[model samples]
Target: MTYALVRPARLDLNSYARATGLHPEAVRRLVALGLLEPVRDARGELCFSPAQVAVAARIQRLHHGLSINYAAIGLVIDLLDRIEELEADLRRLSERH
Candidate 1:
């Protein structure tokens, strides 16, 4: 058996903000809210994965298009987390056969 290690490209805060059209503060807020987990590079500065950058773009779109506030987004995220927890419980119960 062979194992493959994959590394995602790391993006700095400013570049990511420019690339995604999101304010760096907004991304920082998400980080503060536990929505994003930026990685620390060799230089000890915070950076984000490409996938996280992609999600930031999506979140920016949702906010810009729908004018959603952080509170609303937080609520939706909470509901989604509950739904995921319920689904996991359902799967566990079904596995009791």
Candidate 2:
């Protein structure tokens, strides 16, 4: 089987902030808090995945809409990730049976 490789577009800090409608400092804080993961490109500048824009947008809604603190937001995100993992596992197990 041939595998198809798909690469996500990477966004620089300013572009990411613009796309997310968040301030640069807010993105920096998210990176500092380990909520966002940015990797260095060939130029050694920090860049984020396009997919992370959606994640940041979700966090923005949770922070502004629900007034949730960053720590709680982290926990909430983690729980949601766990739920998705469990659901995927359930689906796989059902398919195997």
Question: For residues 1-97, could you state the per-residue lDDT of candidate 2 as single tens digits?
Answer: 8775976689999999999998999899999888999998889877999999998988988988999998789998999899999999999999999
Which candidate has the highest lDDT of all?
A: 2
Which segments of model 2 are wrong by more than 4 Å?
1-8
Worst 10 residues of 1 by lDDT: 54-63
What local distance difference test score does each model get?
Answer: 0.77, 0.91
**Which parts of model 1 have CA positions greater than 4 angstroms off?**
1-7, 78-97
Strongest candidate by TM-score = 2
Q: Candidate 2: TM-score?
A: 0.80
TM-score of 1: 0.62
What does candidate 1's lDDT look like per residue over 5-97, in tens digits?
876678998887787777889778888876677987898877987788767765666667889875576676677679999999999999996
